[model samples]
Target chain A: MQSMSSSLNALWNHLSDSPLLYLTLTLIAYQIGLFLYQKSGKKPLVNPVLIAIVLLVAVLLITGTPYDRYFQGAHFLHFLLGPATVALAIPLYRQFEKVRKSALAIAISLLTGSAVSAVSSVLIAWALGGSEQSFLSLAPKSVTTPVSMGITEALGGVPSLTAVLVIITGILGASLGPTVLNIVRVKSWAARGLAIGTAAHGLGTARKLQVNEEAGAFSGLAMGLNALATAILLPIVWYWIF
Target chain B: MLFYLTIILLCQLFGEALVTFFALPVPGPVIGMALMFVGLLIKGSVPDGLSVVGESLLSHMSLLFIPAGVGIMVNAELIQREFVPISVSLVISTLLCIAVTGLLMSWLTRNKSIGGYKE
Candidate 1:
């Protein structure tokens, strides 16, 4: 026991000196958690992201480490989000010929979709006595992270909270999407991609790719275009409403 | 998967360095993503080795998001107070996003002029 304590003390001192060590370890730990999550089969509650979060939280608790420290290293992974978002353009570009052909219809649908999302939420929340910021966060929930975070900040909601909602929304959409699609008897690749991306955002787009290339491509288009649309529209609506 | 992860990590480091030097408002992951995307675009096709890594990473993208999601607890007070707007926005936006995307795609493909043709 005494020797273990000394070893732990040495390790702690090492991590404190080179904080990136903790970040690297945290990522490794997350990957391992993911491996275990998959190995455990398709239980909804045992979702890998959920598992990884729980594991990391426990690690933070035991090690007495601060979130800022973890974020210092983990932020690297977060950084990949931007390019990954743009990389979405690849699949989208692959489908450009088709997308270009359908430009008008796509534009109208996105416009309507954006408005409905923003307006209905505010109206409903006002009915329920929800605050303006609550309405603000919900307003950009369907868009990608960076845009949504910006909208949240602009509308006087918590950006971090928006981030959480975005993740949850993405997970729920990805996991439940296909099942629901089948139930609704929705057919066609465009329908699949549109539904996945609109409902799920980036993660949903990733999920759509798993089923087929066309679906993935369309999903990417939906996510990106919607991101562009909402980024432009959300603030305007916020100004109009406030 | 390991190689892809390493590359992702390297991008993260690069993103941080660049952001620090330039003081950009952009996040690191976003920068890393941009670098990787450029590399992939220039390459045109994902290399066989990296393809495997990307597939693995993308397959379980949810796991990568979990830690951040749980970070919600940090702002529990704000969320509790702002729950109405946030929740409403999510549901409404999701519904809108789906409806718009669907309508647009349908309209675009109405004549079957898009990429894939109807059989």
Candidate 2:
């Protein structure tokens, strides 16, 4: 019995170190999330990122696995975030000429949108007695994942917390943003796309892409522009204000 | 394909170098994105391979967020403590931002008559 137990322990250790188990698990969870998202007819509520997180978290908790160890195997996926962010330039370039017609309007509108979302979120969180750190994370929620995390880090907040909040904000914006725009009587796919993209980033762009090509294009432009603007401006503004 | 990917990675590496050397607050990738955008502009068009690889990577961009999303488990306690404030702020602010942004875009572009947005 002791010898068998020792071999079992060795087997578990080797499996854990290999990275294949958790890596496969992570991909599988995302696939499950994607399958459900498509089955639900691309409903925003069935956000694949959210589902994957929940599934992975449950798995980690059940298996008594530490996050560090799991990340050891899963960081392969994480490493792609930087390259994917760099690739965002392609779509932004594709839409450059289209954005030129109303360049000033789009710039001013997106800048205003970014400020409102960031300031409002921080103020609301603070008013509700949230800790300084959480509110700092909330301030960058309107931006994309990598940039938002960087902003949060600069502001001395939790980067990981900011990432989760960013994703959640994306889901909320994609699902309800159109309704909000509709109630406000905002027409024109360009306006719709810009607003959703400014507030929600890439996921919102994805939704816009599916619903209307024009909206998706504008949304894609908005996301790239907003990411650059907020990443560069927010920290400057934060320090100037504080 | 390999050549395009190497360029992308080189851009990212250079971005990180700038951030470190200058202590820039913005993320390295954002700068890298800007660099790549400028390069594209100078060239006046995207290469077929670059566009293909970039689009392919981006098509499943949501998949990329999964690992970091799972990091939430590590912050479960912080989340519980901040849950109410976080949720309320996210819900109210996202909708409000969308409305405000859309209205602003429409109002500002109302007179332009470009793209038939004359509302």
Candidate 3:
């Protein structure tokens, strides 16, 4: 019995030492999250990304594992973000005709939305006595994760903090965006999708995609456009204002 | 699938080259997306393989962000201290953002012809 217990302990230690352990754990957690999300009838409130993060955090805490260590494995998944972002052009292409028809409306609305999201976030945080770092971080909160993280780092804010802010912004936007659009009498799929994508990025795009194809396409377009606009505009705006 | 991925990586490489050459502040992937958009425009249609890969990636888009989202653990202290400001701003600003964008798009496209479509 003693020999068997010692062997099991050795096996556990060996598995824990491998980077694959964290990678496998993250994938498994996300699969569970996806299951729950589907089981819940794809409700926005049961966000798989949110659930996966919570589960991973809990696991890390329970194991007393450092985030940096876990990230070593998880970074492989993170690295895919670049290629995935480029993949967004596929949907945009599929909807190009519709996008071209609404070019003026889309461009104008995107500009206004991007500006409003950035400015309002900073102002609200500042008014509530958020530090300078918080102010800068919040400035890019509404943009997509990868772009926003780059913006935050460039602006001297904490990237990890900005990452958190971006996710929460996405969750909130995905949950409340459709209802808000209905309240504002925005009935068009293009408008609804663009609004949510502008505010929530990929998460909003995912939500929009689940509802309607046209809406999803526009949301994807808005997400990419917002990334470009925020990356270019926020830095200039920050320098000009401060 | 491999070919499609290669195209994406090439676009990203081109995007990175452009950013570095111009010293643009934009992320390479965003630039890559733009270039791919242009490529599609020139091509006039998305290839089946490209669409397949793209759709797969996008379908799992939320999962890609999990690594970063879990990064919240690193900022626990800062978040704890600034919880009110952070949460309040996130909720209010997101709502305002949605409203502003939705209203503006709906209003601008109300005439229908301006957007070149009747809907």
Candidate 4:
């Protein structure tokens, strides 16, 4: 009995020491989140991303695990974001014909939307007594994660802080965007998708995808275009202004 | 699956090379996406394997972001300090952006029957 208990302790320690433990935990937690999200009628309010983060944070805190350690395992999932981003071209490709017909409209709206998203956030942060670092970081808050992080780093912002802001921005956009569109009488899926993607990036795109494929395709297009535009324009505009 | 993964990775590899070579400020993945888009345009259609793989990735797209989102804990102090500004700007600007974009897009395309939406 004593030997069996010791062996059990040894097994536990061995498993805990492996990076795969955290990775498996993360995937399991996400599955639970996804299940909860579906059970809750897949409402935006019960976002799987938000739930998973909360659960993981709670677990990490309870177990006294460092964020860096958790990240060591989680980074594997993070690395896939690049290829997933590249994969977005598929939906955009499928929607090219629709995009071509309204190219001018899409361009005009995207330009205006991107400008408003960056400018309003920066202005608000400045008004609220945020520091210079905050201004730089908040400027790219609306772009998707990887692109936003890159832009924030280039613009002399805190990329880590920007990552947080970007996720919050995405969650906010996903939750509130549709209601705002409804209030404004914006009924078309294309317009709705464009607004969500431009404002919320990938999270918003994911939300739009749940609604319909057409909306998803447009959201993907908006996300890609917004990433490119923000990447090019933010730096030029920042240098010119500040 | 292996073939599709290779194609995706190859595009990303090429994109990283291009960015490094040009010293571009853009993220390699964004450039990779653009390259892939252009490739599709030239090909005139998305390949079945590529779309299958792409769709699979995209279907779970939200899952990929959780790790980065969890980084919020690391910046808990910064967030606490700038809580007001961060929260307020995120909420207000996000709303304004959505309203402006949706309204403008709807208005601009109101006269046109485009993308199956008769607006």
Candidate 5:
């Protein structure tokens, strides 16, 4: 035990300045999360991503490591998001015929959903006496990270606040989306996928993708389209309103 | 394997270039997905190799989101101050949005003739 401690100390000193430590930690935490999630029979609340993130944050706080430093190492994984997002086309292709049939429905649903979410998100916060800064940040909570963050910045909201809200929105949607859909009796995978994607963005789509390919395809499609829709519409609405 | 990866990356690069040149509001990866979709439409099929690579990447797509998610803790102070409004709005609005959207989509398609017809 003493030798192990000394060796651990030595290894830690050797890699203190490098990115590999956090990178490896992120991966391992995800695996642990996966293990726990699977053990729980895929309970939505027992989300692997949430688990991994909580573990990571706890580790960061415990170690006194700044988020920026950890991000430097985990960036390699983050970079893959771009390529993975691009590859969504594969499922979209496979579901193209099905999607094409409901193109009109998809378009209308996306617009209404995206608009309602944004408007309602802002109004809810404002109604609750939330600050104006919170209002601006909440407006783009349904969109993806980079796009949402950009929108928040353009509108003079706190971009970081928006990013965090976006993630929280995602996690909430991913965890509770199915139950809500069930309560509303939305059985069609396409509608479920669109709803999840529109409201939750990538994280919700990820969960949908795991359950059904048809839903996953639509979820991904919804996510991409919502990104575009929010990007264009939010600015116009922002200017119109304020 | 590499060829498929190359195609994906090349599509992304084109997307970035288009975004830069036109100052498109959309994210590059999203445009890249659109371009890839169009290419697939012309190709008339998903290449087996491409499917393999795409599936591999997507299967673990959730893993890719961690770095950004972890970035959340950086703003714990901001969240803590307005925790009530933020949490309430996020939860209620999100659930309401999904329910409304899903119900609308299903209702719109219930006619079986509008947005449901297929060849």
Candidate 6:
């Protein structure tokens, strides 16, 4: 027990100095957590992302490491997010033939999705007596991170809080996505992909991949396009509403 | 790998420039994505190695959220106090989004098929 605590202390010291080291270690730990979750095979509830977050949080709590210190390392991986989003276009491009056929439908759907995501939150939060600040954070909940962070600020939400909300929203959506789709009887690859990305963002894209490559590709495309659409439109809607 | 890295960087730089020039509200990355999408559209394919790199990037996309995820610590007090409204708002908004998009696509596709003969 003493050795364990000492190692944990060493871990934090190493993490504070070079954050990337912490991220690398976190990734490995998450992989192990994932394997365990899979072996137990309860499914759905044992989502790897959720498990990783829980385990890592506990590890940090026990090791006396501050979240900010851990984040210093983890954020480098986050910086790659933009290039990763751009990379989604490859799979999307490969499926261009099918996409071309449904281009108009996709555009309209994404636009509608973006509007509903931004507006409904404000309305509901208002009805529930949520403060304007909470409304700001909630308004861009459907969008990908960078854009959501921006929209949160533009609409007077807490950007940092918005970022956290974005991750939780993504994890929840991704975890329940398949079960929900099945319940809705959605069968088309395109339909499933659109649903996940339109709602869940990157985590949904990850979930879609587990189901199939086409679903993943389409979900990635939807996630990117929706980010673009939401970023441009949310502020306009926010101003009009508020 | 190097070539794709160059393209990614170029796209980012170009995207940042467009956003700055247009005074757009969108993030540079979103603009980068749009630029990359156009590039892909023009070329009709992602360059060979670009596909591999792109795949690797997508495979671990969730890792990118960890930093932002950890940011949750920044507002524990706020979240605890207003957890109900915030949590509900996030979940409901997401569901509404999915339903709206799905229903719109379903309806639009149906309308398109019903209105005209296919090629």
Clashes of each: 19, 0, 0, 0, 0, 1
Q: Chain B TM-score per candidate, please.
A: 0.68, 0.87, 0.91, 0.90, 0.92, 0.85
- Model 2 chain B scores worst on lDDT over the 10 consecutive residues at B110-119
Give the fraction of reference interface contacts each candidate recovers. Answer: 0.41, 0.73, 0.79, 0.77, 0.72, 0.61
User: Candidate order by lDDT, highest to lowest?
Assistant: 5, 3, 4, 2, 6, 1
Compose the digit string of candidate 1's lDDT tens values, residues A1-242.
99999999998787765648755765677677657756878543455565566677677768777666666647656654554554454455456666666667656665675566557766777787877666666667777777678778967887887787787678666766665555554566776687677667777776677667678876766666667678766777668756
Model 5 spans > 4 angstroms off? A1-10, B113-119
Question: DockQ rank, highest first?
Answer: 4, 3, 2, 5, 6, 1
TM-score, model 5 to reference: 0.94
* Clash-forming residue pairs, model 6: A19-A73
Off by over 4 Å in 3: A1-6, B113-119
TM-score on alpha carbons, each prediction: 0.74, 0.89, 0.93, 0.93, 0.94, 0.88
Under CAPRI classification, how is model 2 graded?
Answer: medium
After superposition, which runs of candidate 6 have C-alpha atoms over 4 Å from their true positions? A1-15, A40-42, B110-119
Across residues A49-104, which tens digit of lDDT does each residue of candidate 5 receive?
88999999999999888898888888898888888889999889998888998999
Highest-TM-score candidate: 5
Interface RMSD of each: 4.5, 2.8, 2.9, 2.1, 3.4, 4.4
**lDDT score, candidate 3, position A148:** 89
Please give, for residues A1-242, the per-residue lDDT of candidate 4 as tens digits.
Answer: 99999999898678777778888988888898889988998676787788889999998888777788888878888899889888878888887877888899999999899999999999998899888888888988888887888999988899998998898888888877888887898888889899999999988887777677777777878887898899899999999997
lDDT, residue B71, model 3 = 86
Tens-place lDDT digits, model 4, residues B28-91: 8878888898999999987788888998888888888888888888888888998898888889
- lDDT scores of the candidates, listed in order: 0.65, 0.84, 0.86, 0.86, 0.88, 0.77
lDDT of 1: 0.65
Tens-digit per-residue lDDT, B31-116, candidate 1: 55556656775777666666565555555454455546657656668778767655665654565556545655565566673344
